[model samples]
Target: MYHIRASILFCGITFVFNFVRADYLTIKEERSYADPPTGDWVTNGVITPLDQEMRNFYIRNADGVIEVLLNEDVQIGLQTRVQRGGFEERKVEFTIGGKRFSYDLPKNLYVKRMFKDAEAVRKWEERGRRPIMDGKLYLKPIADHLPTPEQPWISGKFIRENGRFIDVQIGREIFQIGTQGHDGQHRFMGLLGQKDIKPFIQQAFVHGKLRGDVFHASELCLRMLEDSKAQDDPKLGRYLFIGDSISGNYDKALRTALKGKLNIYHPPTNCGPVRKGVENIAVVRRMTNRGLVGM
Candidate 1:
């Protein structure tokens, strides 16, 4: 009787353990790669044999890899891998059938998101999240045309024109981009309308210097644009702002700042009549009109 009872208890415990495991799925890497190539991938979302409700799948491939099987051949975001301490998780995004999904993927997995669309890849690099894929850094261009915001200004990363490398500080859903240089100058840029300009400008000058950068400086004020342009590296070819007078005024400043290496291609091939939608400039003008100065 004792032997039989003990055997039954052991079997029961084994069954319970197996049952719990079956409820969850784990996909771990059996191998690792430093730089997994970039491209489009379709995954079989069902990892376990009994996967019925198919909700999430674990991706464990290597340092720079994420194993993802698609649910219905839908497009997905790029996933990249970064050396654990070298890169931080970015809230990269993707969409399937109009439903958006975001993952805090590493740099390596991030590069994978650019597959299928070279343009997408270019934009990702400009965001400055450093995938460094293909053993060399590459910058992809953003879509030629995007709908202008009704408020007449592009917002945040959307204004960069390149979607990949522009890095920004995020606060309460707000994206801030810029940094200070050794010369006591603050450099930054973004897509915001009139309302946001004062707060941003004030923040930069509160410390007693107009060391910040604005993304939507209208070309109408060429002097302002030129002075601001002399603060960055243009040869990097990572990001370039191309527009009309707004962009033109900054042309020489941009060249001087970058040592005459970077060039701005005026009259954006995609968005001509650049002055038509100068919402950012309008905001600047409004700020000036209100007698708010220095930022």
Candidate 2:
């Protein structure tokens, strides 16, 4: 009876120890990938796959399993490897259905939400100016056409009406462009109606060769300045130039032309690319409120 009881106790203790060890291993595997608490899905950033079979990748969470399909003919691009502290990232790109996509997969099987459209995915791969797709329209960044901060005014949307006219909406302003033009030249209207802007438009035309749209924008700015001056606004005399080395040259030329008529303010350091302006817009707005104009 003593031998029988001793054997039974030994088996029970071994079973309990094995069960605890298995539980620890399971928790450790899940923690290694920084996985969300059982059921949550990653909303953004790199998406790592838990497992892959042929062209289908399966992601298993507490809620259910999600399967991503990558066809065989998809062309994969070069991989980028990044390492920071204890974390490691490997990003891969592939093109499918004429659209390119990219995602980063970690060794521990952690991932983020994938791109919803090709344009959003393409923006990440290309540098400098690129077209952005919003619904049915493909719009260019404002900085690509004008010397303005590239964030706020990101191109325009066009709506076709009656098969003869197209209405273009840029920010809050709308303009009508006809499908037909005189002598094969397109006609642009609705931009020349402001009375205060006419003088600046004439001035810009007399000075040099300038694009019609750019001249219109400059005239609009001038009109704003005139209005502010008329109201004795404190921001009327101040200006801020936010750009790179080339813009510095333009700033110097403008300063010489103004000749103490306006106070020009720019960073003592290089401002880099248009992206820097997009990133620090909040700081720019604060400075503008403090009496800086056209920042």
Best by lDDT: 2
Give the CA lDDT, 0 to 100, for residue 78 in model 1: 21
Candidate 2 residue lDDT tens string, 57-87: 2222221222323333321211122123212
Worst 10 residues of 2 by lDDT: 1-10
Global lDDT of model 2: 0.27
| lDDT by candidate, in order shown | 0.23, 0.27
lDDT of 1 at 187: 19
Q: For candidate 1, lDDT tens digit of each residue in 1-295?
A: 0110000011112111110111222323232221123321222111111123322222211111122222332222122222222224433343322344443422221111123244544554467534222211112322222112222111222112122232321222322222222232211211112222211112111000111221111100000112122333444332233343332455445546655553322212222343332211212222223222211
Error of model 2, residue 154, in angstroms: 52
Per-model TM-score versus the true fold: 0.16, 0.18
